[model samples]
Target: MGCARWARRAAPARDIYLTYNWKWNVDEEICGICQQGFDQMCPKCVHPIECKPCVGECKHTFHVHCLDQWLLKRNICPMCRVNWVIFRKFE
Candidate 1:
């Protein structure tokens, strides 16, 4: 009779490395245009604007549409006279 040999295989565990870059700015809870708290919908369109964009220079939050309307008349931030300078890192 011939003897049979069996071999066992083991799986190796892999380690994953992840890196992330996050940029966050503090935003007020109320929309200046609507005068409504973030928990409420935009007063103009009656839509949610949570996490809505804010003026980087002043940290003021506003509904996108609302800001658009305001921007039509002026190029500066509504709350601040600061020119709307889009942020970018020059190389």
Candidate 2:
């Protein structure tokens, strides 16, 4: 709807920068589906040491495992009800 803004500042490593930027727009620091912090291991994490987060086209974020489980039942995002596509993925 409007011009997209790109930050002029040099970015941190991608995973760090993207995750940190999301914090400002988020009301809660938890994944909408699993109710766990993005960096914490939710019950849904397939591997204990690696809980990647995925950002959808709607800009809502979720633990990848949680979102995968969700996508199995419905294609829309649990937070925004937008058609969920993996727009950006972070490790």
Candidate 3:
């Protein structure tokens, strides 16, 4: 066949490696309460999903678990010390 020669020279991939890098779209790179990166798993959380980034009305960012625990002690944001109001939780 006309294409046989080229096909025979093609090298087969013995191994494949893949990776990706992603970050939350927030102003803060680290959680105020936990002091951990928004991309990192919260210390109190067992799964990555539970450590999702959360934003407050004051525009501060925190890990979900970190914020949740901080809220239990006081009703104010850990960063700004403002009234803690959940603006949104990013999944």
Candidate 4:
């Protein structure tokens, strides 16, 4: 029973670890507005928000500043135009 419970707990942790640690590549996660890698800043902005926002469905990422600016005019993903505002993951 203890082993089974540990396995259940470990599975999600492993999945999350692999999902982020294994699959995450800085080269691929470029900010659309700035065209910079994850480690870089948005060109139009001076200060950088540590956790960037990603649209969950299409997996497009952006700086919070850029996304918020876009949201002011339109409530959609800049890349896919998929009615964004919700379903976004920041970090």
Which of the numbered candidates is closest to the native, going by highest TM-score? 3
Q: What is the TM-score of each candidate against the true structure?
A: 0.51, 0.63, 0.78, 0.53
Off by over 4 Å in 3: 1-13, 46-49
Q: How far is each candidate from the true structure, as Cα RMSD in Å?
A: 9.0, 16.8, 3.0, 12.9
In model 2, what lDDT does residue 80 have?
Answer: 75
For model 4, how does the per-residue alpha-carbon lDDT over 1-91 read when each residue is reduced to its tens digit?
7787667434443433432222224334777866776666666656445546565356677777777788899887788878775546555
Clashing pairs in 1: none
Clashing pairs in 4: none
Candidate maximizing lDDT: 3
- Decide which is better by TM-score, 3 or 4: 3
The worst-scoring run of ten residues by lDDT in candidate 1 lies at 82-91
Worst 10 residues of 3 by lDDT: 4-13
Q: Give residue 17's error in model 4 in angstroms.
A: 30
Error of 3 at 5 (Å): 9.7
The list of candidate 4 runs beyond 4 A from truth reads: 1-27, 44-51
Q: List runs of model 1 lying over 4 Å from the truth.
A: 1-26, 49-51, 86-91
lDDT of each: 0.57, 0.73, 0.82, 0.63
Q: Summarize candidate 2's per-residue lDDT along 5-87 as a digit string, tens digits.
A: 65365757655444232332333478888788864667955643477778887878887788889899999989878788887
What residue pairs clash in candidate 2, if any at all?
Answer: none
What would the per-residue lDDT of candidate 3 be over residues 2-91, giving only the tens digit for each residue? Answer: 697557665776887797777778898888777888777788877665679989889998888777788889999887898988898896
